[model samples]
Target: MDPLHYRAFTTPSGGGNPAGVVLDASGMTDARMQEIAADLGYSETAFLDPGDGGHFRIRYFSPLAEVDFCGHATVASAVALADRDGAEGHYVFHANVGPIPVEVHSTERGYAATLRSVVPSVAPLDALAELLRVLGWERGDLAPDLPVGVAFAGLSHPVLWAASRARLADLAYDFAAMKDLMIAQGWGTVSLLHRASPDLIHARNAFAVGGVVEDPATGAAAAALGGFLRAHGLLPADGRFTVMQGEDMGQPCRIEVDASGDGGVRVSGTAAPIPVA
Candidate 1:
């Protein structure tokens, strides 16, 4: 099988989060896929099995384990599919999390995928102290503008809003220490963010739980961030915004976030193929 490597959320191929995409993973065992993912060593790899009609069965594997959903990989997979099949129309994906629908469109920039997340919910303050302790972040580092909470779009992520943009940029922590804490908490990723404006934000995702120090651009976390913003009334009705991530790492990904008054959030970005070894 030919596996495609892709960078999602950025127009340039070199930017965004890199993912391995196997468009046709027929007869591949879970163990085999897991091994491949571990060897590839991206934050996540996607295996897609085209089913009847336009439906597909998708699986996401991290280096250390399997995850319910992965946004960047999904975007990469969709773009890979469009590259072979042409860009246009909606593709349905059956993931461990649930059914996810992705719409593909051709734009002046390139082929972009807009993914609608599974039913999302925000957690009430339940494990704030433990979560903060894991990231080595003091409670005082939190911004009063945004609330601290757990948001789930597909996978679970603890959203921590930094008090300032500088705080978000200066990301340094004990990887193993944070990994142990994330394993205990069962978190998929940690969303560390700084609000640049009411509509624009900068984000960083620590993925030590996935055996990766960080993710360049995380679609799942972006979706969770949108939900968190809407739930806390941080977003205005009919608000549209962009999130700049991976810049600190020099990857520089851009994710477009749109919030509807009905409470559903849509995240859009481009996914370009990365060559697989």
Candidate 2:
């Protein structure tokens, strides 16, 4: 299998979250795919099984295990497909989460892919105290406006809105403790965020559950964030915003979000191949 490394959500090669893309994983077993992902050491790697026409079956695997969905890897895979297939207009991906529709366009920035996630829903806050204690975060650290809640786009992520940007930047935490809580709660990641403006936000994600300290940029979390904002009436009915993540890790990623009045959210970003290893 030819594995390609690509970074999603940034124009520059050094920015965005790096993902390993296996363009063809037909003969590979699940164990082999898992081993490849673990060895690659990215938060997630996408395996694409080419199907008839432009449709494909995609699977996501983390170093520790396979996940239902992954946004950055999906973006990376779409760009990889475009690079090989001469920029197919749009492709349908059958993922573990559901049917994901991705459109690729050739821009000055290269292949920019936009994916419309499955209809998102906010999960109720049932165990906020347990989650807070596990992270060693005080209740005062949370933003009153944003609040704490669970949101799911493709995967479930607990949204913890920080009261200040400083708190969001200070992200050192007990990895083992967080991993325990996340695994027990079946959370993919903790979506830490600080609102800069009504339409702009700074975000960080702790992905201990995925066996990664943090994710540089997370598309699934971004979709969940948009859903959280709309579900809680934090953003306007027809709102659009941008999320800046991965800056603290020095690989800044920009994620554009659009929330329709009816309830769907769209996330868009640029993806490029990383330098060959």
Candidate 3:
């Protein structure tokens, strides 16, 4: 398959998470898809099998394994589909977890994509103490007002809000231990966040579960965070926020998240094509 490389959740100049988009994966086997993803070596690669009634079966694979869903890949795939089919329509993706609807529009900078996630839910972390030990962080390092739990939009992410931006920036973790913990707990990623303001947040995601050290831009985590904030009363029912991420890694990314009253979150970002090697 000839895949197109696109950087999702980035500025027009292209600083975001890179994803591989296979516009057509018609008769590909699961093993072939996994091999292709490992070869590409991106955090996530999206494969699409177009179906009738304007729907497509989407699958996401990382270098290591297949994930239930991926936010950045979803956005990237939406933009890719729009570019191929014309940038003026909405596409429904039948993902492993649920049906996610992505709408593409023509922005001044370029084409942008917005995905409405599945009904989100939040639950308390089962092994909070073990998690803290693995991260070498004390409970006091967390924000007092923020909720500590695992939130799921499509995949599960542990929502950990730091007390300060400095705390969020100081991210040196035992990758092996964290990866083991994530796998044992069946987590997608560990979302580290700092609330800069009522409408702004700084985030860094530990994506060891996906066999990546960190994710420059994590749409699933952002959507989960929005749901957690609403469920915990930290934000209103209809709230919106901006997430600034990937700065420490030198690839700055911006993500827009909107929370609705019905517990559905929308994640929006712009994707740019990357030069193939």
Candidate 4:
């Protein structure tokens, strides 16, 4: 079957990250799924097998390989499910990482999805210098208060706080080298962010591991960042923040992150349908 296209985390300004959703991928082989994902050329695509009672099994694939968990694709798939079976507003997705509970809501703009991430954890990067050199960033470029570390929600991301928004905007790096490092470190993406205010943040994600230069909007990374903030006691009193991503790429996306609950970080975004060419 053909795939449905949607741009997840879209704002009024422009479409966000593009993802292909195969709503019914019951018997598709792994090689075929890989080929489809590569042909589609999105950062990631979701293959869903609907189970009984609002449960589904999902697998995520990038242009090059399969991913454990993907936030944007999950959001896209959940919204797609909402658009299809309006009767079910929530679903339980069994992914490689774990079960993800998705809550869908109807909004004026479109359908929105909130996925609670797997309980997150943070740890120091063993080879920070190598990653920094590959990213063209120095120790001084990072926020002194927020130490760089690897944060995992559903996927692992190297979370680094940019000392300033200017540092976040100037995104230049060696693609092959970045890819090698990411693969070696078992990282899905490198998250670079700047806190614009107490409740607002700006972010850029390097997705070399996925065979993409950058992810315009990354839900997993956003959730990871929220977990990192909660761990560091840096989040606002409500443990929520508004993330502004893809601004540098001119396809601005918005993500709402909440880590108030002790269980898992909640990441929310709206998805808009896009025509497949």
TM per model? 0.94, 0.96, 0.96, 0.98
* lDDT tens per residue, model 3, 66-104: 998899999999988888876567889999988999889
* C-alpha lDDT (0 to 100) for residue 239 of candidate 4: 94
Off by over 4 Å in 3: 236-238
Which candidate leads in TM-score? 4
Q: Which residue pairs collide in model 1, if any?
A: 5-274, 6-274
Give one digit per residue, the lDDT tens place, for model 1 in 1-277.
Answer: 8567888998554587899989899899999999999988889999998898779999999999998899999888888888888757689999998888998999876799998888678897477787677667788889985678889888889888899887888888888888887878778888899888887889899999899889999999888788888777888556677888998998999998876654446889987766545
The 10-residue segment with the lowest total lDDT in model 3: 229-238
Error of 4 at 73 (Å): 0.6
Q: Report, for all candidates in order, the number of backbone clashes.
A: 2, 0, 0, 0
Error of 2 at 144 (Å): 1.9
Error of 3 at 219 (Å): 0.7
Native-referenced Cα lDDT, model 3: 0.89
lDDT per residue as tens, model 2, 98-159: 88899998888888888888888987878788877776789999988667889998888988
